[model samples]
Target: MNKFGVLSILMVLISVLMFFILRGPNADLPLIIIILGSLSLLGIIFAVISKKWLSGVIGVLSNGAVLVCVFFILLAYGIAG
Candidate 1:
């Protein structure tokens, strides 16, 4: 696995863990979301630049996971309304 793939996996895991651990009006939630989103985006960019199928797939999955987590966070905070 390339550096992008490894970092992508780490960021995704950290984001998932933070999503579960941080709940109820935590100030860090938005920061975490931003970090996850940025890392995911970077992963996608790296995948594109690298032009590797595996990296691209991993990047897409990682980005999707970040989006899902963001959706849930917004829903939980009633921001979706």
Candidate 2:
């Protein structure tokens, strides 16, 4: 894969790991939103500041995946707990 492909895959992997690894009684909606939103914002910043289109593409794609994960996490939280 190319640079953007690698970065996008890595970002998605890391995001999922973070979601699963940080379970807590603090599984509250507010905390989840804060953390995920902040991370997404950071990704946006990285994309904006990147020197290449590859990096920007990776950032945008990764941000999308992160949003998906956030939705799933919120869904899980709503249905079961």
Per-model RMSD to reference: 3.1, 4.4
Q: Which ten residues in a row are the worst by lDDT in model 1?
A: 42-51
lDDT of each: 0.66, 0.67
lDDT of 2 by residue, 7-78 (tens): 544555666666677767666675765677667656656665664677677777788778877777778777
The TM-score values for the models, in the order shown, are: 0.60, 0.59
Question: Tens-digit lDDT track for model 1 on 1-81?
Answer: 677666656666776676667655545766656766676676556655555678668767776768776767666657733
Cα misplacement distance, residue 2 of candidate 1 (Å)? 2.2
Q: Per the 3 Å backbone cut-off, how many clashing residue pairs does candidate 1 have?
A: 0
Which ranges in model 2 have alpha carbons more than 4 Å from their true place? 1-14, 24-26, 71-81
TM-score of 2: 0.59
Off-target runs (Cα >4 Å) in candidate 1 are: 24-28, 78-81
